[model samples]
Target: MAYKSRIVQIFIFIITNFFLLLIIDSASSQNILTIESRSDPATPEDCSNRWIHIRNLPSRFNLDLLTNCSDYPLFDDFCPYLANHGLGQKTHIRSRSWYRTDPLLLELIFHRRILEYPCLTDDPDVANAVFLPYYAAIDSLRYLYGPDVNSSFQHGMDLFQFLRSDEPGIWERNMGHDHFLVMARPAWDFSQPLNNDPPVWGTSFLELPEFYNITALVPEGRPWPLQEHAVPYPTSFHPQNLTYFEAWIQRVKRSRRTSLMLFAGGGGIGSAPNIRRSIRNECENGTIKNNISSSSSFNIVQRNGVYSKLCHIVDCSNGICEHDPIRYMKPMLQATFCLQPPGDTPTRRSTFDAITAGCIPVFFEELSAKTQYGWHLPADKFAEFSVFIPKEEVVFKGLRILDVLMGIPRSEVRRMRQSIVELIPRVMYRRHGSSLELRSKKDAFDIAIDGALQTIKDKLGDTLEH
Candidate 1:
């Protein structure tokens, strides 16, 4: 009995000590440096910390932006944020709502700078634009928070619509110009674009088309991928350039990030039965994503497989949601494998988000996983990167999610985490390619913004001479 007790005590001590070391080691991982606004705008609060300014928008937009950027909100005391809604913890008020931005809860938003893309294809328009302010708002947030900061504007909804509408030169007007779409809310109805007050306009500055003159001939440097040919704007790069770059850098920094992986699950706008049926068979039995039924939109029917009780599917539109941090913390932490099947291009945070929470992403092949970011996740490298499932084999073809995970070897799952840890430095960036410390040194955001701003500045430069 004495011997057994001593062994048990030693085990407990080791376990406790292990956790203590983990906490201490992880402390440095949380360092973040926010970009303070150079000029305080005519707004309610200073733009110093996370507080920002919009020319004619309400305080709501600014607050939301701050919330999105921080990923970790410090506004519990300052604003009526928790009460306002969707940061996960909901406080019933005049209406029921799902608050966004719970540290453990990940939500995706599809935003379009619909206004910035009014088809200004003129050569003069593309030359002198300075996209700094626009990018500053975006990249700065991305650095501090994980890819939890997600929005698609450039090549997502705006382009798809322009092409489908076949408006004269619409694609020509916006092609090759790199721009990020910052969004609030999750849909595309032109009327809903505006609320009670000043209209919230989607904004992005135009830059020279990718095919434009470039100093790519820098004697001795990585030959920058030639900007997409005369396509008018940078289409594929919009949604994931930041993370891909960051992941690439993360690999360099951590030397143990995941390498090859894919995230495959969920429909674009919401979970559609058709989508659910289609994705069921991609996996083997007893896998993670398999348990969640893909049959219903925003469907919680299959959630029990992931959760204990059938948690109430709270109404999301009105405001905050029932914040269940405990429910998600373990899931988020243990989910080294997350699935993001193909359906919509605009807002699929479900995929990238899996990356943020330290999960390896498993994707369906329908979307442009690699061509978009030069990221190729082969089976051998699967342990290093995301896993991409081709269209035909998605387990849920009226199949099952459990089968999907079972189909892949447990070795593959562990390999995915290895890839992510290795790629974290390269694919993710706080400043552009800066270290996790949010250092200003060429952050992944800066790399994208700098290339973009250089073009915009040149264009806007002439205009300022007046």
Candidate 2:
């Protein structure tokens, strides 16, 4: 009789547990947010017609602006994102210390399922799969006013919150307004150990997009095609600010007592010795004149009766970029042309510094030409605003780089200086000085800034008082 009782009890327990398991599974399945791709055309006329409010874009906060170039190998037009994976379902978008947004919205690009939630995902295809190109306006004023609002990114808890949900194995494929496949991930954020060594949080994401000027984007680059994938690269054009433009204008107002001043920094890694030699040699030559160069190594060359390296740094933590934020302001305040070259790529901060300091920049890099529509900068409209050394010419024993600087006539040089000067207030020059004079390359950068600014002015353009 006892044995019979034991068997009956086992049967009852098994039945009860089976029913409970079914209930739990059903409850867990309720209302899960699923993300999937939307059927939208690549180019829509209305895309650029409006301004968007970005809470924070991964691209804005992750990539290093000084080192980033549009033509760099990583800048897309070559990444299919999810197609290379052997299994179509295992699409993992890659992000590094440079790109943070790519992993936030991976599911939306696949179109395999629907996003049932209002957030982002860690999957690359799901994160960057679907995003809107928004005219960016960062909240710099808020940060500036707060002074202590160092918000914690908490090891990208914010990103993981949006990209990777809390529960494991519970991913949804859906697109949200914050979906964007950023090219890189920033290692740093406001949260830090406070005693941790370099690589410091947010090196790649140093400047937040919420703190900068961004305008106009379109859908052009997608991660996947319409039928199979949804990850699209951003096709919306963004206009750049003309940092060199204002420098040119500022030069027109300066006195004649100034000599040339050039300060070059960005040491250790990006700072190459030969490139530094090239810059110093040009400045020191009598034929290639420069007033000053802030040197980090060796001495600033003395050419054409001008000084170089009024400032120098062997190694500095914060001091590397501090001294004269404006590359040529102190020297060019009295001089004419600033000896500027492309830093690794033609898109470094030097381009903005020289132009904004009222000094003309001489482009000596092959990449400089690429910045001008990936064609010859001499033939481009920007050619009217800056100077370039023709790549095909040779003036030295064989053909030295310095010879190119000497070969240009004074008349043509003067014209470009003046044109750049006139464009300053309209482009790079800002009354505050914090928001102007940047990569004087991209027409999109220039156009977007102007268009967005004009939009604001249009609101004020009304001859009325609120």
| Candidate that scores best on TM-score | 2
Over 4 Å off, model 1: 1-129, 132-273, 277-329, 343-347, 368-383, 395-404, 407-412, 425-437, 440-444, 450-466
Candidate 1, residues 200-227: lDDT per residue as tens digits? 3321211213223221111011123432
Query: What is the model-wide C-alpha lDDT for candidate 1?
Result: 0.31
Candidate 1 TM-score versus the reference: 0.37
Local accuracy by lDDT, each model: 0.31, 0.32
Candidate 2 TM-score to native: 0.38
Name the best candidate (by lDDT). Answer: 2
Q: Weakest 10 consecutive residues, lDDT, candidate 2?
A: 228-237
- Cα lDDT of model 2 by residue, 1-466, tens digit: 9778656545543453354234323323422222122222223333232322222233333221111211233223112222211011111243110011122112212111111112323332323223322111111111212232254223233443543454312223322322322221111222134334542322211233321121112111112211111111211111123443333344456545234334354433434444444444444542432434434222433443433432222222343332223333445455455544444334333444455444565565544433332211223566676656543342222334444533556677667667755543332311111222333233322243333334333433342354
